[model samples]
Target: MNVSGIDIAIQKSERKTVSIFIERDGSVSARVPAKLNDDEIKDILEAKEYQIFKNLAEWTQLNENAVEREYVNGQSFLYLGRNYRLKIVKESSGIVRFFRNTFYLGEKDQPKAKELFIQFYKEKLNSKIHPIIERYKDQLGVAPQQIKVMELQNRWASCTPSGNVNFHWKCAMAPIDVLHYMVVHELAHLIHNNHTQAFWNEVDKILPNYDEQINWLKINGSGMDL
Candidate 1:
């Protein structure tokens, strides 16, 4: 069904025996509830269909321009291409800290604080990876013209044909091996402009488990929200 151009795929929920709900992605599901006749089911579904359609319509209208920065406190956004749960902590001193699951705020919980956190994380990420980048470059006898960390909404790491490599800050969230694979992935782009069998061979040369790392990014990358 179309809810203001947000097409919804209706499905029967095998898990829920009875009831219906809308998914976060605008899909609707109707659970076959026990003791429900065709008329009752139709009534229930019609009611839910209207409600879901209305909600979807409103959201689609509101989010036509979703990329425009709407920095709301406590609302999550992407940072360094990774998602870090943001928690505002009020303290007298101004200090920002990144931990396993959350970021702590010290007397400075503002939108700029978010930017600062991103900057600070970039610093840490650079410290963590710069040496490795240097080592790999030296070993391969192929130096990237430039190395930089970035926030890319589309791709994780991109290397210009000129050998300038830009990495997503979210790469830091991956495991050390996976992170190294990401670096190697970009480096491979220096040799092969597109994904080909030769490209896979180059990646395998540097990283044996590159396929697993790529799969990890696909499955869990969205969870790394800022």
Candidate 2:
């Protein structure tokens, strides 16, 4: 619906949530649970849609602003389960350097700060992810056809019917054990293909503390920044 003449893309899911998003153009889409009937949802769109859209828009903007403020120019982020700040600098020197408790990125070219954040994450943390995966692979005895790292939107990691495993790059943001658990979880799917009891048993046999990783992901593992 148009709040200030913006068009929105609405998405409905089975999960329990009700939210509205303000498009960059000022249009808003009301995201609601699938449990909501068309009539109930229609009433919302017909009445108070503007107010609802505006409020959600404000909240979205505020949250984005906070993230930008915290992540840019001399801000901190949790990486490899530790706190690392983005230290903006003016030197022709290290654009992204890691000290004892901080990550430094040169802001001489501030336009690419986000890109620098990503590059720093990849270069500094990727080497560490493989060893964790190898440890679990040995424990599981079942190996995925292929392991791929990428940015995931809906699911943290996925196992294709072909037995390939693709992990969300953000999994790097999780603790070491948690990353291992995810690798093992996906590897288990390479054998089981579904979330059945035997599948869970396979997981428990190799990763006894799978529940902890599950809880961690639930509490802390998702972001599209939108």
Pick the lDDT winner.
Answer: 2
lDDT of 1 by residue, 1-226 (tens): 4433445444442333444444423355555645566666665556566676776565455444344333343545444345555566666234456667566665455646756656766777788778777666654457788888988765667888788998777676666766777777777777776556787888887777788887665555645534
**Global lDDT for candidate 1?**
0.62
TM-score (C-alpha) between model 1 and the true structure: 0.58
The regions of model 1 sitting more than 4 angstroms off are 1-88, 92-95, 99-102
lDDT of 2 by residue, 1-226 (tens): 3434445455676645556654433346777678887666666555666676566656465444323234465456767665566666667454557787776766575666666656666555467667766777767776667767766554668988887777665565668888778778888887776556888999999888889887665445433221
List CA RMSD, all candidates: 14.3, 7.9
What is the alpha-carbon lDDT for the whole of candidate 2? Answer: 0.64
Clashing pairs in 1: 17-32, 18-33, 82-224, 83-224, 83-225, 83-226, 84-225, 84-226
lDDT at 53, model 2? 58
Sliding window of 10 residues with minimal summed lDDT for model 1: 64-73
